[model samples]
Target: MSAITLGAVRPRFRPRRISPARWGLYAFILITALYFLLPLYVMIVTSLKPMAEIRQGHLLALPASPSLAAWVKAWTSACTGLTCEGIRTGFFNSLRILLPSVVISIVVGSLTGYALSLWRVRGANILFGAMMIVAFIPYQVFIYPLVRVFSFTGLGQSLATIVTIHTIFGLPTMTLLFRNYFASLPVELFKAARIDGAGFYQIYARIMMPMATPMIVVAVILQTTGIWNDFILGLVFAGRDNLPMTVQLNNIVNSTQGERAYNVDMAATLLTALLPLVIYFGSGRWFVRGIAAGAVKG
Candidate 1:
């Protein structure tokens, strides 16, 4: 009862309402983030270190004087095999495959989505369902059959064949994405356009497609990453003369008898990852919004 002056009490300064489980969740996230970032940290540090340091096995030591020599070597002089011509030889090869693959995949995906979304074409739903079913299957399973088909069609191991292979592999997910997105859009828009004497392509191009920027961005992200990072498909379809940087990187990293330049290997890996990382960073605002979530939900 001494000095018992409980006026307003200040609510006992109640601790902010964060449970132990929530705290644990945050702790888990922080550890997980550190775990993922470890590789990047190692690479950056190692890339800055000279080959001398790399050979000395100081994997995490800070460089005494940071240099871009490793990066330069990776760009213009490192050898995949005997030739020290660097990874630049196939830079054009990747671009040749990457550009056409991205463009054609988007076009085919957009068309397929538009058709499946708007038109009541016969067997359309069945075909779409089949596509969805096939989407879940690992692409490796399709490679043998497709390789045989392409080889027979005389498109074997060419850029065009690689592009087609990407489109085929990309079809299901791309179609599903756009179809679901279009389905989420108001049907009245398409109906009104139809009533105004607009044809399918007209409505699609002039009206609906304009509103599909988000979905398209999402599709671009998926296709760019998948097709760009694609080693196996590019390896099997892109042929000897057209081996992508990924294939070159594999050769550099995996050459058994040849001395592995870990520093250059790290730099090369970072370089190879730059494109997809660019796409992700560029469209980062909309990239966070899951493409199909709450899209059409009432």
Candidate 2:
């Protein structure tokens, strides 16, 4: 009989089975997703339902007869004041404010963040701490003071004034974002640039800015959302001619007289919200990465 020698046998690879904990996690995620999506579902279906069907009081049910009339009315013929010109005017006005405000705020914030992170200037810490404290204070508290200051400067209730207001309010948060992101970078890079005789602007323009693509996207998303959806600030600062879509949306929905067109109201609300939703979704990947990078060190 041949002697059978015990030899090493490699274990076959087997796929791991899902644990109960993982299944529970999946269930929890599905529940949370449904919760968040509930409102959006309601808004969409409500917008599609006609005034007749809506009057039947079947809110949760799918529209028996879907119609695009509400969307058409909200976009082209909704009355806000004597003008029946829909939300188009306000849309253009918002774009004018949004473009300039986003550009100026991001530029100023990036510079401020860069200085605070890289330079050890006198009173920098005190200034940054003061800014942080200001951020915690409600924006409503600044309205009166800001109005007074704007009136004193003769910039009251105009495009420029609104843009300035957005910039001012956006600064602290933006600075903190970029500052933390910069702080997470390698110190060696700065030292190497310094060894090459690069000054502040040179180092920033060539090195820092180039490496800050993700954070810039993040800043854009934040400023766009806040500045776009701002009803109070726009109403206060964006003069009559410059009223944003949100203000127009409010006028359409909050009328005290005449039959309330719920369908049109919902459509207008969704349309006003579409811009921010687009920005959020478009920059979703960058937003996550930027936030992660910013939060890494500080």
Query: TM-score of every model?
Result: 0.86, 0.85
State each model's C-alpha RMSD to the native. 9.3, 9.8
Model 2 lDDT tens row, 153-247: 99888999999999998888789888877888998999899999999999999999999987788788778887899999999988999999999
Best by TM-score: 1
Candidate 1 lDDT over 1-298, as tens digits, reads 1111223245666556899987998999999999998888898988877878788767667887888888998889877778777777766778888889888988898889899988888999999989877777876788899989989998888888988888988887778778877888999989999999999889888997899987777677777777778888888988888888789888877873657777888887888888877877887644444333212211
Off by over 4 Å in 1: 1-27, 290-298
Top-scoring candidate (lDDT) = 2
State the C-alpha lDDT per candidate. 0.79, 0.84
Q: Show pairs that collide, candidate 1.
A: none
